[model samples]
Target chain A: MIVTPWKVSGDVDYNRLIERFGTRPLIRGLLDRLGRHAGHLHLQLRRGIFFSHRDLDWWLDMYEAGQPVGLYTGRGPSGPVHLGHLLPWFFTKYLQDAFGAELYFQMTDDEKFLIHPDLSLDDTVGYTYENALDLIACGLDPEKTHIISDVNNIGHLYKLALRVAKRVTYSTIKAVFGLTDSDNIGIIWFPAIQAVPCFIQSAREGRNVAVLIPAAIDQDPYWRMTRDIAEKLGYYKPAQMHAKFLPGLGRGGKMSASMPETAIFTIDPPEAAAKKVMSAFTGGRPTVREQQELGGDPSICTIYAYYYYLFEEDDAKLAKLERDCRSGAIICGECKARLAEIIKRFLADFQRKREKARDLLDQFLLK
Target chain B: MIVTPWKVSGDVDYNRLIERFGTRPLIRGLLDRLGRHAGHLHLQLRRGIFFSHRDLDWWLDMYEAGQPVGLYTGRGPSGPVHLGHLLPWFFTKYLQDAFGAELYFQMTDDEKFLIHPDLSLDDTVGYTYENALDLIACGLDPEKTHIISDVNNIGHLYKLALRVAKRVTYSTIKAVFGLTDSDNIGIIWFPAIQAVPCFIQSAREGRNVAVLIPAAIDQDPYWRMTRDIAEKLGYYKPAQMHAKFLPGLGRGGKMSASMPETAIFTIDPPEAAAKKVMSAFTGGRPTVREQQELGGDPSICTIYAYYYYLFEEDDAKLAKLERDCRSGAIICGECKARLAEIIKRFLADFQRKREKARDLLDQFLLK
Candidate 1:
């Protein structure tokens, strides 16, 4: 929800990016009604920092040309998603509806099964279909989207993978992906497998079209490698828009699904959402007198950061909140309450969509 | 046609083999006049050198049980055939008609195209059809035998080759095939490709039956590799009848297609055949008088060697030639004349059949 500022080495300067990319006037205007779109597709201008991309103009060009581009997003389905996992899918769905881009949501169930010895074919199949429901619930177009379970769809891409394997070398793959001594052969091939979909989606039947990928910054390594291979294979490289990692309510590092308490889920009740925010990590000084004189550091405070990303999208409102928090004018408790209310409304609508997606699962599976 | 005695190190010991694996008098007498039974197929007894088989009993078992076991043979299609190539097809045809085994004869046109870089596809295709005529000319049953070119029939075996490649390792492949640094990847895979036909002829709807490959001993390595793979793949290893290599009428080595004068071709005119023999390499002493005085070494005399292999089918007659050859009583020139006469008679029937085959070239294409 928030553009979590990244540190290359030491200090995080959020103002530099505001100056570089600039703020969207339309996003500033739509602060209250965030998810609504004027056209068939809805584009949510992301404040989250997923990755720092090089070429964003090509995606804008495709959008301007009325070309049929698509939103390609996937999950490993290793486990139920944390709050961190929702960032890409939500952003992807926003772009899908906003630009009317066709969506391809791949459930990497086979990859999970290959990597996780404990996972069974039946178990992974069950998990992948269930996970598809969550992604669909996030508002991706059921008719326009292709939610692929890798094993079931292996036949479609088997020949292409072999062709890709022929062109790539072991040395190149290792260097690009940062593969270490313990990496499995399947993992080495997994990147190319992912790259295949990026190339394949751009073509209807072997003609190159344009594409855009919205994903977390960590996944940029795979796409970078994909960029190198695209021209070699006579396909276009997809432009990327990366959102920054959302920190857990516990603060510091990115939110992890493995530790459930630190991250909130859409399925979580209103009461639980309110309770989680109240106990969130804070940056206020201990003494009441000292805290009143010296305001909290909103940069270090997880609750204030959440408001900037999710609750308050207007630059003026965010600037006022940052000033009040730093000057000890607004307390952390009031900010927490505001975030809890915003999160509650978001979850209620998301949960309703989740229920509708479950009913439509059969329609997606039909031929 | 005479039994072409294929030599490894020296002359073939025909009399010794006649005592070793020859049919019993009663069996031989019954086979010589046995009428073709609709339910029971028979393997026609060819010449003496095309003897010493591994698993003919299983095929006989299948036939006795009223199951159809087809026959298969192939020509290399490198050039116009010498006398050595004739005996195999001659025997294959006799088996097809006499025993009613459905025969499939392959012309390795694709292999020739792969191996001979100077050859155009048109040249190889033209030569294969031409050689198919030669094979049919050798008296093979046109209705019973299905003759095919490698290029057309390659798809039948490609699936089997991929399956074989997955099971074999690079190290095992290198060791078995004598592959060196400069060999092409195509050459490395050539053995697996070759082994596919053995499996194809034996498989009916992917079930492995039995196959009998009648080739010279030098080709044993191919079968040995096939045998190892056959067991691994759960298919029956092709049973083989390893014949000895026929000596060239030139120097000490085997007859090569590159040397036009060393071997008697089916297309060779009578005068040319006679001249080739008269001037063929000899193991005789200084002069005709000395040859008569000192006796000839039949082991080193190409003229008498051809007689023992091809023209002299009468066991007692071959024995007399051998004895006369060793005693210096038989002149090399006199021996070549008798052999040439026999070869000329064989080519008369061959040319007539070949002429008929030429008329039905389209029939061989199966297009």
Candidate 2:
């Protein structure tokens, strides 16, 4: 598997990824302890979608002691928000509600413009506005959240970025991000800017506050590097819960925004989204008649993954649907149509809230 | 000879440096043309102290054609301002006054704090204020000057810094700056910040304006890199006039701020500065009686260099002083005492203006 902040390719093995990134397994015991305080585990934690972590139990201990824990996650607004981008954000919203934590949601427009040479600052900044609406549509509490646009709020971040950058060398950048001398200096300098939101509350409040970051495993490298310099800058090392990337509708790989054919965007019309869902790849069962005598493998189905990862919140219903697929009671066409209808309903509600969010955008911004 | 933005070492060979850095010599023809418009050349220009240049004639042509040519120069603000640091800024003031230009005087506090590991941000920022006072004391018109502190005014600069950073690769950074992988990422990122003032007018005014930078030659590498990307960013490539370093009191080299004994700081007391001049290294004669028969070499004297570089601005009187020293008519003690009084008088006036600058600091700031 190839996973850097910029790219994730190949068939990912979460267990192997846990070892490579040196994170602790998100075990049953930790989940049980977390649920005790939260009153219930988030669906991602219960289902082990968020499979690895670092310093999470310590953060929970601080949370349980009535110390405030801040949640920091970010979006690099290069394009329209996709389902893959929403996966961790939805879970982060859950973390916020469950723990009553404040959220610092960073919109890294500068990173997108720098990493992608063709994208202008105006383009990324435009996307920043569009994506902020989608984030608000995810049902995050606006009063408790601060949306930080890197360029717009740069004066607040650049000094701390300078301090963070001083502790990190180019060797660390090369080793962590898989960057080379061919990469732009902005990309090399970006890790420090990326680390800023983790300490934003601490810097503003003039005291240490526990921070918990929930992001895909690919972003764990940034937090690992941030953790190394945290104490040196007189801030606590941020804790993180890492999630597995949501597979694309095409096949079993991370859903990417760059490939519009592989993922559904939140901004897409409900009907268009339904069309994408219908054309999505699934487990191959040649001919319906041949499948009546044979069993289908639900394990390889993207349609089945949609039900398990998001759509079917009911565990028994998801299990019954999987059983029906294996017994030939459910065919690919019907299964796809069911997932399509569910997606249409979701986008219909989401898009309305998204438009309404435009009115509230200024209220949420930290600028 | 070695020169990077961070370090200057050995005896810098100006002619060899002109060839090495690929700049045009400031010959009599350019000076004669420049003097025509300004009515008279600045002492530094007339004496060839501002020795080498890049596109200076083109900038002057633009100025002659009724286009605004902005002046961009900076200080890193690591410590108190020294004579070596003042050499170029004094000439830059001449440029602004001569051509009726705006000045973007950048205080690179972020660069100082980032490159110097032991310096806290507070320390660099404090020095920024201190250095800004000295800059204002140089007789720059407050109405036409905008003082930019890199950390405080980052919102105005970081966007352009990001744009500049995107075009530059780490390979270019390594080759131009001699930065290693072990160097902090901040040092690698700072060239872009240092380059911003060159295009500040263009970025703010929504049209390209010519900019002329007057700096000592160590800073040429940054301007060269800026020139490479200026057209890409839709700004005119900045013109430059380079100056040679002022020799230290102890020996031949750039008068370093880190070595306080070798340099005279603007904040230094007039008496203390005079005392430093009295003990300064000069071309030696074993006995005064023998020096009448054997002429002393004024060419190797740092005291003589002070008169040539700054103190004795009268060209005729300076020529006579050099002639008398060569003829052994002027002894070293009387020469040192006279030069000491010149410095004492200069500082006594400078410190008063420096104090007055404190009240006007806010008017000059870009923020």
Candidate 3:
């Protein structure tokens, strides 16, 4: 059994990744055009934690040819969208604007009823539509995107889904998704439902390759299963862009939107955002002089990590900050203060866009 | 737990049966009308054999008021309609012509597929259309009679059937139909499909208080399950008229159309019908004198039983035949000869009608 080498400790090898997933001609051209107009912000293609690939070149070819490749992103809508939930939409919105790709966002509302026993059937359907506004507010363009809720739109797609579902067996699903016996039969059946849209990407409804699924690393197993099935069903394998999990503010495991402090909502007030930042877990020693003598552990400091991920647009600014932190030229509190301003300014722009999107929710939700 | 008296023995105590179910207007009137039309050779209602009731009063009242309480009969359509299959149709056709009530005959194509794996999907569908022509040839008026096959006509009725099916459970179906784990799931799901049409009766495509199910007593379990489910689903329980099982020519058990010797098809030649009749199981001793010394048992004689079911039109003729057979006054040979003649002549008119019906098969088989 041969294993792919572009992985490190079961995570993506970031340095070897660029040559592994060479940028498509169209995306490279678009990046060049952006540099001409707005300057470069580093041409990075995020790789998911659980890396798997099939026919990436085909999608890249389609992208290079300026053919339409629809952006497919969806959430369970089990709860409110948090910082963790924003990753896919952030990339999707960017790609849609950058490459003019068609975007399709879905809410798996019917699946919630099957998964959550306490949820009333009617309430399960109502929540998906209600949550659609929040996703649109996250900068998804109505002109380029079509939003679908599983409850209302499923009827149109169910027959196709059921056909694919019937071909995949329970054992194969269990092996790929790590499903246990205690899981509801509905949950066991969920991967097939998600896989249907991947095969349905072409403009001809039941025809060829036009789908691109941008999901987190943990979700790669589902796409892998879909790819295997697509080969058997004579449907094109959907192209994938997998991203690593964003760590929570506590420097714990993955960030979860359902947990409050772990994820910052676009609506969080500036004071609250500042407080979250001040208390954010740091790896620096108590005194600045001790930190200067010992230098800093940037890997363990959550605040510095956030700055690298969210701010630090210039290479000189990032290098100076790293050197200053090591020499005690900058303390954790001063660094947090700088990070709070970046967060506040980012939220302000997002909130304005959210307000404008809310005004046009009817157009996105489409009744 | 106390079981009903009728549960112990299959036989119904007439007085007790009357106290329980006989007073229903349909039951009383059906018995009275069968008595009134006894003299007609071509069209007459059968007596004593059909002995069950549910909401029979409503239909009888409709009959008494000169309203359209039509004749209803069905064939399983697993095989060609035989001599035994003609019993219910014979009476139903008589009742239709005698009273001018609309007729609704059913071909249980779906049930065959459910119960027997050997019956292919194509054959199951084809049998219904083929059997419809047989029913039409048996003196049924095409305009007055509506023939339905379960699968083909499912869209016309499946929604109501599914609702009625849900109300019936594993426990209720198992008890009434004697289903076990070894039986196919299709068989388990089939009773409700059969039951729905009983409650809805007209398919809402015809007149009211108009449905009657003329079936064999061996199939009493299906309607019993139907009645139980109808009460649960809040639909009207249908009126039932059950014919006794016609015995097989060789075995003491019921005659099945699948066995060529037991069943005399309308397509059977006169010589073939005569040969089958001559070889039928008899209760007579070797010699006529030996039979006289020890009286023949009509219960064990298949030939005498056929006459009791079909040939003995009048009560006086049936009683005389029964007495003569028990006393050994009539030889089994002579009696079989008499029966063969009656059957041959009866099929002569049927054969003529069948040829005409075969030409009209296209009109009926169309949607």
In candidate 1, residue B267 scores what lDDT? 86
Compare the candidates by TM-score and give the number of the best one.
Answer: 2
TM agreement with the true structure for every prediction: 0.51, 0.98, 0.54
Interface RMSD of each: 9.4, 0.6, 8.8
Task: Tell me the tens digit of each residue's lDDT in model 1 across B78-129.
Answer: 6788877766665666556655766667776655654565664567767777
The candidate with the higher TM-score, 1 or 3, is 3
Model 3 segments beyond 4 Å from truth?
A: A1-367, B1-30, B33-46, B62-72, B97-103, B201-210, B231-234, B292-295, B323-329, B362-367
Candidate 2, after superposition: displacement of residue A295 in Å?
3.2
- Is 1 or 2 the stronger prediction by TM-score? 2
Model 1: per-residue lDDT, tens digit, A1-367? Answer: 1332112222334345434444212233332233344242222254434334435566566656776566676777766655677767877776776767666666666556555657655677787777777887877776778876665665444334433443455456556655443443344445655766776565445667677777765566667667767777677777776566677888576676656777887667867977888889977778656767998888898887776556676767888988988898888778788888888887787778877888987655412
TM-score of chain B in each prediction: 0.81, 0.98, 0.82
RMSD per model, one decimal = 11.9, 1.3, 11.2
TM-score of 1: 0.51
User: Model 2: per-residue lDDT, tens digit, B1-367?
Assistant: 7887778898788999999999999999899887887788889998889999999999989988988789999999999998888888888887787888999999999988988878999999999999999999998998899999999999999889999999999999999888999999998999999989989899888888999998888899999999999999989999998998898998787788888887999989999999999999887587887677676787789999999999888999999998888888988899999999989999999999999999999988985
Lowest lDDT block of 10, candidate 2 chain A = A289-298
Query: By the DockQ metric, which is better: model 2 or model 3?
Result: 2
Pairs of residues clashing in candidate 2: none
